[model samples]
Target: MRPSIKILEEDMKEKVVLEAMEILEEIGFFVENTEAVEILRNAGINVDSETQRALIPADLVKKSLKTAPQSISLYNRDGDFVTVLGGDNICFDPGSAALNVLDQETNEIRTAVTKDFVDFTKVVDQLEHIQAQSTAITCSDVPEKISDRYRLLIALIFSKKPIVTGTFVKESFEVMKDMLVAVRGSEEELRRKPLAIFDACPSPPLKWSDLTCQSIIDCAKYGIPSEFVSMPMTGATAPVTILGSIVQHAAETLAGLVITQIVSPGAPVIWGGSPAAFDMRKGTMYLASVDTILMDLGYVEIGKYLNLPTHAYLGMSDAKILDTQAGFETGMGSLLAGIKGVNMISGAGMMNFESTQSIQKVVIDNEIAGMTYKFVKGITQRDEPIAKNLLKEFDKKTHLLSHDHTMKWFREELYLPSTVVDRSTNEEWITKGRKSIGERANETVTKLLSKYPGVSLDNDIIEDLTRIMKYENVDFKTKLDL
Candidate 1:
């Protein structure tokens, strides 16, 4: 889409960049970590000798960002389904941590499980706009020892799209490395068309975790696009103000960029966050508050200053129950963030502090993502006569099935809904027992997985991937593993 489709206009962008430079110069980020400080200084940022407060030259930030190649690709055994190389294309992905009550049999709302993850992945893989899958699905059943990559392994089986995931520990890094190798067929293939991974750092004063830093370094070396998602909870985690949260997010992200870029100058990175504020009344953190949305918008604006792609954690709710609040929170957040051109907006399909994930919400949120894509494209005027002449050619007696125009328009204009909004007539619904969204979603997941084998993967590559998944402790050791 070039800079034209950029969320920030030229004059607007320049002004923002200039102001950010000053903010960095005057206030400076509280980056005490020597690695981060030195990297910023080496990159020609002006750092205060004692405090390590720094201001990066706008030119350097732009240049470094420009080096991040506009596009990145991830492949399945079949081939690349998502290549975020910059286009009019915008799609929604999975939310992290499904901690709500998914299995009604249990009746208690809690964390998601390994099987729950597999089920959720199937529903997402079935989605159209969710071009990449985030193994944000949680595996609550697995021992903590294997929980991190456990969901990722389930995702690997179900998704052909690139899976966005995190490494909570050093060993999970190997699991991810091997997972990509399985998808790419070999280390050489992985290096050639790297998988995109989003990594996060705890916000300022706090440093990148030992596991996360190690993972970033490991990911950079392999050419995978590992982005930094710095989450700062204002009021609770930061200063309880949106502006304060933005700076903290900026500091954390830039520090990550320093390390990642140093590890590999163009180690494909995105500026992203999960920052939000706590609700004082309820004593809970609201993931979809106006403060959260606005702060995220501000962060993306800052990323535009650096000329990098962006990401944010929106579309999540603080609502404890899965109801209208969950839907509206997800929809509104998705709309603005998508309109603002967030490269990726994580946190969908969940309720309660992002600790729980749900298939029902995943399906519904994906539909929202599809709707958001429509908004981002806005409405374009086509020069063609599907404009007028085709409409005139429409005949009342003829069925649309026989009309070429129907096919043309349907392919271009249709935004199909997932299992969210009920589409059946009352009579039809009655006959079908008025199924809940969850019931339909559960059915949809089974249908997709049943259809998976018919959608083929290369046999030799599949064999190699099987070995890697097994070797990396990601399951799929058996010949029957899907």
Candidate 2:
């Protein structure tokens, strides 16, 4: 049997879904976009224009769910099938839209600039364990209006991997689509093999903003995959209990689903979220709290029960720096999510409760993901009687090292650590100057950036992108010499 983890029982999952439907029917969310409200109204749902509240019937929610695909496939820039986004297929990417990065030179958090996006994308593109690239860090140096599309443009230039990105405002969504079209050379080709998936979030406490609503409509119209990231801080923006927060998340996500499916019947949508608990004493949010992990696992079970692709904000640390605390939280959360078969887990490079991104953290998390992937492979039964062959080998050699069985099994059974994880003798460590994981990570970052292997875009396509950038008057200061 394949490795897996289950938190909610069958009946328990049903209860959560029923409660979510009830919440939708009674405490429906307010629709910020007039078009979205009209869509729901046309679908036989009740909409009160005065309150901006659209009461979604349980049947409508069920119908919308029926239209959502259970799986999605993402393609790379070369038009090659890369990763599937559903079932037990787990994928990991760096965090999205962080304001700052942990500088390797100063060892301090600083506002991330345009070069930071280029450098970060270069590092992520090289990490084997990181399945997709995200807008890892926002470019503070770029114009505020173009920052979202600028980050996507830079990621496309520097990485061949499929991307996970988002735009906060509505107008920029079109600009981002234009950029993708410019790179792909046509709108139909861009839709056929979309290189990026956009994250559309819902304001908590049963609310939807105009910008996010419009983004959902636009993404669906263009056939782009949309990930519904519903963030509910328990005890603050949502119910204090974990289960309560989950129910609210379900309702919020279904509300977005209704809007998307109504706009475009067969557009792709992911059952995704990033729910957390509010730390009352610290007056802060904890995405790495133990409760948060449980919430992620629980909600993933709900998504599986509903037969939808899953995504979660996991493997993140509340701690400001990489330390023992960061290690334990990230390792446990990542391991659980992997075993639970989350389709895509974001927040690999995040720190300080999603406020910062670190390339070193990305490196360390890559190793963590490697270990988790190994564990989720589980053990195999190569032979009918497992101990019989071992007994025969022991009788002959007193050790299995020289046996054919050992040679065949050892390679697949063990997970060797990368250079970032030191498993050396004390003397060897001293010989190598006893560098810490962080120091070793810095070395890895330098080596990867030095030999960054970005895909070669056609000169005409590059010129088209440049023309778009120049026409928009956006600055392009990213260093791509490597």
Question: Which model scores highest in TM-score?
Answer: 2
Scored by lDDT, the top model is 2
Return the lDDT, model 1, position 434.
90
Q: In order, what lDDT does every prediction score?
A: 0.66, 0.86
Per-candidate TM-scores read 0.80, 0.96
Clashing residue pair totals per candidate (backbone < 3 A):
10, 0
State in Å the error of residue 288, model 2. Answer: 0.6
Residue 431, model 2: lDDT of 100
**Model 2 CA lDDT for position 268:** 90
lDDT of 2 by residue, 75-118 (tens): 88778888898889899998899999999887798899877878
